[model samples]
Target chain A: MIIQDEDQLTAAVLAETERAGDPRVREIVRALVRHLHDFAREVRLTEKEFDASLDIVTRLGRLTTPSHNEVRLMAGSLGLSTLVSLMNNGTEDSPTSANLLGPFWRQGSPRMDNGESIVRSPTEGPPLFFTGRIVDTEGNAVAGAEVDVWHASPAGLYENQDPEQAEWNLRGKFFSDAEGVFAFRSIKPSGYPIPTDGPVGDLLAALKRHPFRPAHLHALIYKPGYKTIASQLYSHDDPILETDAQFGVVQRLIGTYERHENEPAPDPDVTEPWYSLEFTFVVEPGEAWLPTPPVSAQRSH
Target chain B: MIIQDEDQLTAAVLAETERAGDPRVREIVRALVRHLHDFAREVRLTEKEFDASLDIVTRLGRLTTPSHNEVRLMAGSLGLSTLVSLMNNGTEDSPTSANLLGPFWRQGSPRMDNGESIVRSPTEGPPLFFTGRIVDTEGNAVAGAEVDVWHASPAGLYENQDPEQAEWNLRGKFFSDAEGVFAFRSIKPSGYPIPTDGPVGDLLAALKRHPFRPAHLHALIYKPGYKTIASQLYSHDDPILETDAQFGVVQRLIGTYERHENEPAPDPDVTEPWYSLEFTFVVEPGEAWLPTPPVSAQRSH
Candidate 1:
């Protein structure tokens, strides 16, 4: 084809990819090309602006590391992750919901006994005793399910991000008992801003948007017959619940955090102010699968 | 507003940017967000596919360095650069056309005298004597204009990509004389593939698309009281002209390469078979502006 104009150019490019064997991939590429052309036209993107955009995208990739996934953060900040998660999971009004699997998730978290604390490192804060039950869509408990839980420290940094924290601080995996109940202990988390030294930060600054995510505990539930659910439970009292930077806070995922003053710890070994949260997760019927973690632990091997 | 669904989430993200003081930024961002969300919905982008896309983008950025710009390459491969350039320049059907300001442009190219060769190092190919005139759309010569010209070597590598070549081989800035004429001598370039070790290569491989760009010479013309035009003149007889990897080959930009056998050289330098190309660039009326060069020469001072 003689590619003289944008339309012809687009058609030529699309035609070149018409032989893509994978139907899904072909569909995606076609749609992507069409939308991208439309975007350039709709905005009349200037050459300078286009150059800047290219630099921004390149910087985003360059800033990402094994410990930090800047691309994922950008996607979440742009609401793409949230949108995709909601669309692929249950409908907006359904019970079986999913959430963004943020970049902090690490595979092979140390397996712990139920009711044990995920806080492996010493920390000072009000303790959070969390309990959750995994159930099927029919309201029946799915016993023997595996629940992986993780959260940030009181300083609002994940263990991987904090040098003072232990290797697996506030991360653990446990099997649900016969009653489909799982419990864990960790310090109550506080909202923290996404890393602002990278491209995502620059974008947030340009958009006049806050980078703080609401305090939350992450969980990944897995069972043999039901789809795995990757979710987070937002604190009911979190000040940033209304404005999570990732827009991950959903009504059904909000959990009430009951505060007690100078109450005995759940393990009865010490006395301190503490908080407790309870929530239930509903898993839908589908092929059981686990998503690849956004970030991985640095290997010393 | 609570962001429970894609529409709501998009709105929330867009609303957060409502206070951007720059109207252009706001407009571009709004259109971007809308199109991105629409693309996702239109394709029903799966979570896995989304993750792969993010990784590809990240890899593209990571692969880019001071020596290379893979993100820019990806943009060109997708035809976004060509579309934006065409849209922002003279009408698609007009003569004052623009082309992709590819990533190889280096700032501060050494200025050369009129009718001088840009080849600074030893090179092996039939010598190409290129002459061009810079004029306005009204057919008036744009005297005293600066024309920056560059091209790849016969081996399909830019001077920067090849250590054997001098720092500024096949790159020079020449001022158009009173008659709006400028000339340079260099080796004839050949079509070459873009870097194939990056994510763009993987994408092209998957789409069954070739990554070869037709042989071409690039020129950036600047004059007072005229808009800067970034353009490329393709070899008229190059087999790949119709399928330029960057989709940057336009009909008006293709130049005929005439071969002279044992004829007197344009310059009384040597007796050898040579090629000559003549092209005319049409500049439009606008503020003179220079784009940020995609790549910069490393400074030693």
Candidate 2:
């Protein structure tokens, strides 16, 4: 029916949306309209404020490109990404910890041997040897699982964001060994700021919030029978872990990184400090799916 | 503080935002976060749905430019613009009946003398003679008030949207005569559909809602001591008045436009079928201000 008042207007919008071809789409639109209308009323949003919001949101879209996903960044900054991941993955109280997909993940990372380095350039900082295992809830090893790993360079820049780094400098894919183990090497990542030259930066500054995410390694594990888990392993000792700007860190996902100095390198080729990281992923029974990466490595200049 | 859970994360985000220099900005951000979190929880939003929302909202921004405002159009399509306008203006139960400041309202309309026509082109349609008065709460005429009038031509296109129409055709500015009266002549406006090639149009189709707004004349009044009102007068007999896509028509704002056949024109020069629209605007007490036009007429082709 045609709406004649504010309340009726909202209802009509929702009612008409019920005819959507997809049931899920219908449900989502209904919720969005209801929540949005309630928000306007709850705040008595003024015209000026509404206009300001439209301007900021529009800028967010304009700033986004194949190499930049401002929408994803905003979602993470607002905690919605974390909330959605947590809610869908496991029970809120004790689900396997998951983190943001972030804007740096790329599709079709080059497959590498178990001990090969994902590092393709002469990067600075301590060498990091990372190892992990994927298993079902029963603790049995899930052999032949695809593990996609990526992280920033020591200087806090992703390969895509830094012109000095080689293509896919710190990105690689590995297959778990028979015992459900996967291992790779790279330079340890350091805490770094999100891109702040755009609208998100303005919001962070205005909110007085630091734009830094704690140093962490990203892993997307996939197996035919287990639910794919897009996860991050945070450096437990990093100063910003507890205050990650993306709100992506969970206590369960933080792991200790053992450091060794002046010791023989694991490969016996390096004469510098090195670190090792290890963790295990608990998978549930479901269809394995991969998230669309927020940004791709190849960007137009 | 370091966040350990969803609640803690939300609290930390809000805490960090308290540093905003402007209190109003702080309040708005706080409300925005709370409502956003609540909406996610209410819907148990999934990652796929979240991604879809990001795509649609991003398109809204990308589709916008200096001459076109897809964001404003979306806001109106959702009935948000009308809601905000009404809530901010007169009381909910008895508002002075404000409407949307649609994208077609160009600033600095050509000034015209009382009883002159806003029409500058050889347009073909029933001649429309419009008149209105501005009064205060005490019902006293508001002399010297400025009235800005604009409307689309019978072909359902504004001057900017149609090259056939001269620059500023069907747009004019006039001052209230000593008796608080203003008048002009132009072709009667026809009901029109909003631009449907963008995201807002996609939404209208998905929601199973029409995009047509009833034929109406826009007016922006300005007086030194009274609040400037941006309003629209809807044709009482228009079929779509009860179902304006923008939800902008109020019961009190609808008025009858009397049609005459071969009658003596209100202005002695006219000898054709014509229509006359008469209405009174009640200005509330407040500072006079003009809203920033959402889009400009001079666009880069």
Task: Provide backbone clash counts, one per model.
Answer: 0, 0
Give Cα-based local distance difference scores for all models: 0.82, 0.81
Best by DockQ: 1
**What tens-digit string does per-residue lDDT give for candidate 1 at A38-58?**
988888888788878988898
Give the TM-score of each candidate: 0.90, 0.93
> Per-residue lDDT tens digits of candidate 2, residues B1-301?
4546665667766766767887777887788788888888888888787888889878988989877788888887777887787778777554564667787777888889988888899888888888898887667888999899988888888888888888988899999987899988887888898888888888778766788889989999988888888888888878987557677777678868999987898877778888998899888888898866645666222
DockQ of each: 0.62, 0.56
Winning candidate number (lDDT): 1
Residues B1-301 of candidate 1: C-alpha lDDT, one tens digit per residue: 3565665778887876787777888898888888899999999898888988988998999988876778878888888888888888877556585677776777888999987889889988888998898888778888999888989899888888788888888999999998889998887888899888988888788887788999989898888788888889899989988767777888888899999987998877757899998899888888887766544445322
